[model samples]
Target: MSKMLTYDACVERIEQLREKMIVTAAQKGMHDPLVLQYSQELDRAHNYILFLQSLNIDNLSKT
Candidate 1:
């Protein structure tokens, strides 16, 4: 089974992806396919964090 990531772990992953994407963009150019792939991955990570935050807000509202 897959394990869920903690908020801190998610943030760390986003940071790691951002750094890798930056390096890749610099070496391969911003339009490179690899860079684009990294960017998409980063976007998904950010979206996941946002989704988690929304869940927390929903729980707070119910409390």
Candidate 2:
């Protein structure tokens, strides 16, 4: 089975994407399509992080 990403990993992905998005925006302009794509990816990463946090909360409540 494939291993699931930990919360820390998701946060790390967000950080990486944030850096990349900034660099892309700087090089290609804020309105560039690639920059928009990176922003969308960042949004997905943030949402995943929230989902992970919710799972943790559920687990803690169950314990």
Candidate 3:
């Protein structure tokens, strides 16, 4: 993985991904499996963004 970026940048990127996923889903229809796949991808990205924003500092001490 790459170095951690600023929270703001990660947020911006996550939002852009969300918008793209929404647009693609809307254009492709909700019933499409690909749309669902994109949604799962967005969920994963969202989770990563949340982790970036709210990670516990204490965990960093582990080696």
Error of 1 at 38 (Å): 0.5
| Candidate 2 lDDT | 0.87
TM-score of each: 0.89, 0.88, 0.58
- Local accuracy by lDDT, each model: 0.86, 0.87, 0.70
TM-score of 3: 0.58
Model 1 local distance difference test score: 0.86
Indicate the worst ten consecutive residues by lDDT in candidate 2. 1-10
Clashing pairs in 1: none
What is the per-residue lDDT of model 3 for residues 1-63, given as tens digits with 9 covering 90 to 100?
A: 155656677677668767877887789877788777767766766777678655655457553
Report residue 11 deviation for candidate 1 (angstroms): 0.7
TM-score for model 1?
0.89
Clashes of each: 0, 0, 0
